[model samples]
Target: MRRRFAVLLAALALAGCSRLVETDQARLCRMALPALSPPDSTIEVVGQHEFPDGRGLRVVYQLEPPSPALTHFADCRFRQPGRPLRSDELTTLAIDGRPLSDVNLYFLVRFWLATPEARDADPAPLGDVADLPRLPRSAAYALQQALNGLPLAAIYALLAAAYSLVYGLVGRINLAFGDFAAAGGYAAALGALLAVGQTPATILAAALTLGGAAAAMWGIATSRWVFYPLRGATGQQALVASVGLAMAIDEFLRLAQGNRPVWVSPMLNAPFGVARAGDFVVTSALDALLSGGFALLAGLTLLAAMRFTRFGRRWRAYSDDPLAAQLFGVSPRAILAQTFALAGAFAGLSGFVMTIYYGSVGYAAATGLGLKALVAAILGGVGSIPGALLGGFLVGAFEAAWQACFSVDYRDVAVFSLLAITLALKPGGLFGVRS
Candidate 1:
């Protein structure tokens, strides 16, 4: 608490000294589309180019609503800065990349001139200086989005591995892992309620810790009490039980926390430019790095333990032949309990990531996540650890690329299509051994 208070005080002191110092490029924003500022209009700067003189600016902007054609791209060019543009200086005004007539350019400028700020700021809004903001990333948008997709990829990898871990051990799918992730979110929320006035970083850290602990405990209990009883049962029986468990968990949380979604305060979201393409820059935030790094460490730790530890050997031996493992005095019940608990912990971490990444966690929202993780597992080879990781990365990359390059409405369609193609072409998955 004291540490958080001290940090808060320091941040406030820093903020008090900061001011909105506009960039040279932002000076161009106003001229690029003063059509942006009046009442209901929304502006998004999509691309920018600077002439050799540096004073000459050309940009592409997307304007929404009240705009002539509803979310159409428009182009603007200015030959001289720091003063109102002359008739010859307003070089181009185009819609959808087709240059409009000089009369249309004058008309748009006239519309901006009607605004109160433009009128107050300049005697001649058409001939006076104006601006909006920094010319942000254009070509770098895809790179930035791809970079952002990594944390989500890590989360999916963790969830996919959880699916693989249980499937390899028991030969039965535990569909409740996604629900377990939601349970972890609930645990985080409960912890957040107790942590008053703490910094966002501290809150996130605490949430993760509490979430993992609670989830591991529940996983252990469920495996021992619910799954253990079904030792000799068929796969469908266990699968149905898993679905029931998921529903019970969802309902329990809905009843416990109410129907409204639990919102998480966003943190560490100040983007810092990291790379550039042309004049466009790519940016990332500290939270992404922190979360992604943590997930990587967790994944590496799990892989190492599974590959080199006595537990790993025991697990592999049991997976190969449970009867032989029992003859060797290995308790099947103990192994099942431990494996499920580990899987639960990973799922919990995944849930924590999802909540923080999206800024909220919902009671029944994780069903899709679980289903997707299952697909990721199958796509990579259901029982293969490394395959799970690869599948998750591929899925995340696919979604990010599709969303960046094409319409977002079809992103899911693309993912499901990939799954269908993979299943049809390679039933055992990329890494799965032929049965």
Candidate 2:
């Protein structure tokens, strides 16, 4: 606690001293589009250019006399080609000789929609003023993009941490972890659905208990039946076995549910206004509150399991050395079963969250969830629980951020890049000790 406090104090001091300062500046020039001869052209001729910040620009010419033939005049949509414009954020505005209504205008400004302080400090145009417009990537813009992902990143981190614990103790990258999480979310949804008019407390308590128990059962079954016999097999064989288990579970779910994506009622769903920061958007009241609660519970549960319980101690002993642990009269099989059950309970709980809060779930839900959690575990340093959680969040946040800036299709790229970079720089992950 003292160390954390000291670090917090230092961070506060640094924040207090930090200010937005522009390291360099360049000229920003505008391009004028040629007048349109045919006023009724279906396509508005907009010139595309970029700023030093790599922001895209569009230039539209307005006709002096508004033409009735042109029904759709393009407006100044300040964004680069192939980039999705964020709602309410400022982009470049173009001034052209064409009638504002007749010719729709657009410009790609490479400037980031940063905080007022940041904008005020670095108002200089980026790049040389030239006839043709120029665009470049901005450090400020990239930083802002990164910040936008922090909240979701935080949530993913929490999941990763929880997953790491199971991995550390079980030494099996339980493919079902994501499924269990999905189950938790579904259970929460089911509970809420059944208790529509009940008080919030009753709904939450009942849902958690029922859902959690169900998940626990799932975990126990997996450990006792599937994973135990494969213990003597090499890690590679175990990996294959896990894959088979995942396929079987998914198929069972598919048979039961028919492969439809189901939506669950979020126990707490309220749309609140989010304050937009430089590039990052802050979470609203409910998002922040729920995320905080989940994080706290996950952390405490992990600590309690590791530090206070006999089972936990035995689990640790087993994790360290199963042979030694068995000599001490610890039943490795029993412990393994228990651990799987516990992990499954967590997954079920996650299912509730995913279905209710996130509003989506399907039989194959674990496919992505399991892989990402695995990545998170590995990134955080496999065999390290906290590391798993941290890795999960990092992967989640990065995926979110990358999707926001680029295409959602690029989400995989973002995760893989992080994985590669982490492996290259710190093979053990952010939390794992040097191997």
Candidate 3:
């Protein structure tokens, strides 16, 4: 028994280590600031740009107030793709385009290991204005805000899709959509932590896989217990029960994790300087591009599948006439379960992007997020996927404009105001048919 237990422990340890490796390139990039300094002088990293192929990094930094030339940089070169350098393999170091002797490199490494930033390599940008294109002040500000808001829009769009899907099939809204998203956010953070390495590509893959799967499972369970019982009830009754379910999820998360926010360290948040107006500049990051692009791709793929597949035909048939679909041998419970699973998957993806882009997910984050998504669904035309997507972008853009032109305190108010206007004037959404 003792021997078998020992072997089990060893297997578990190896499994953990297999996924949590610190790659050679990640180690070198973490030491970017220290690599370019001698430990005696104060230096800070201003900008860091990775090579297209991921084997090289150009770190741009500056010395304290009085310096030799205002700016200096160091290029940390790595080996070819398959031949990654080991942690101890980096012997020679470069500082301000000059080679550092082995002796100096020794002290720098020791000092870096002692620093806080070295321990937590958060990818939050340190502001970049290098090589920014000239643009009018207003244009630059607008562009900057839009770049920041793009990811938020993607997140909203995804959550909105969840609401639309459920409403289209069941004639009821899932008020717990935000909590589902929050659950996905936590799962995604765990996925990143368990990734094979800190490389952007690998981490992204792990996060998406785990996050989407977890949320889909959560949705299935929710539909099983929560919505299944209410199938024979009125829509208002289901809506009220869903609201209660939302609160239950929130309380459960709060009690389980306490009040602390949970998330993985941000990675690849370095910005690309886009345009500038004097000292003011606009920047965007690859993180935002990946967020929006992946969301758009996922949304398009779902649309295509819905349009081209037999399953899509059945789903549409069920949505149009449940009695007819049942008469044709389609199961209502099965359809409902599948729809919830898909919605949960979208919500999970949204939460993953939110956590990755924003750096953390708090317990109460779901409340406001759910409210905004519900508004998006209603404004765009509830029960319509394309409408939800368009509504999400519009809401995101509106929030950006409000934050830029006015104070952010009333952003929610503005959004709710839009909801009121839409309901009062349009009644049915852009795609939703009027009763």
The best candidate by TM-score is: 3
Greater lDDT among 1 and 2 belongs to: 1
lDDT of 2 by residue, 398-434 (tens): 7756776788887876776777787789888877766
Candidate 2: deviation at residue 319, Å? 1.6
Q: Could you give candidate 1's per-residue lDDT for residues 248-364 as a string of tens digits?
A: 888888898789888764544444455555555566655676666777788789889999998898888898999999898889989999998898998889888877666678877
| Candidate achieving the largest lDDT | 3
lDDT, ranked from best to worst: 3, 1, 2
Please report, in order, the local distance difference test score of every candidate based on alpha carbons: 0.70, 0.55, 0.76
Say which prediction, candidate 2 or candidate 3, comes out ahead on TM-score: 3
RMSD of each: 14.6, 15.0, 11.6
In TM-score terms, candidate 2 sits at 0.62
Task: lDDT for model 3, please.
Answer: 0.76
Clashing pairs in 1: 26-133, 30-132, 84-127, 84-128
- In terms of lDDT, the poorest run of 10 residues in model 2 is 20-29
Q: Which stretches of candidate 2 lie over 4 Å from their true place?
A: 1-155, 158-162, 273-283, 433-435
Off by over 4 Å in 3: 1-132
Model 2 clashing-pair count:
51
TM-score of 3: 0.75
Model 3: which ten-residue window has the lowest total lDDT? 15-24
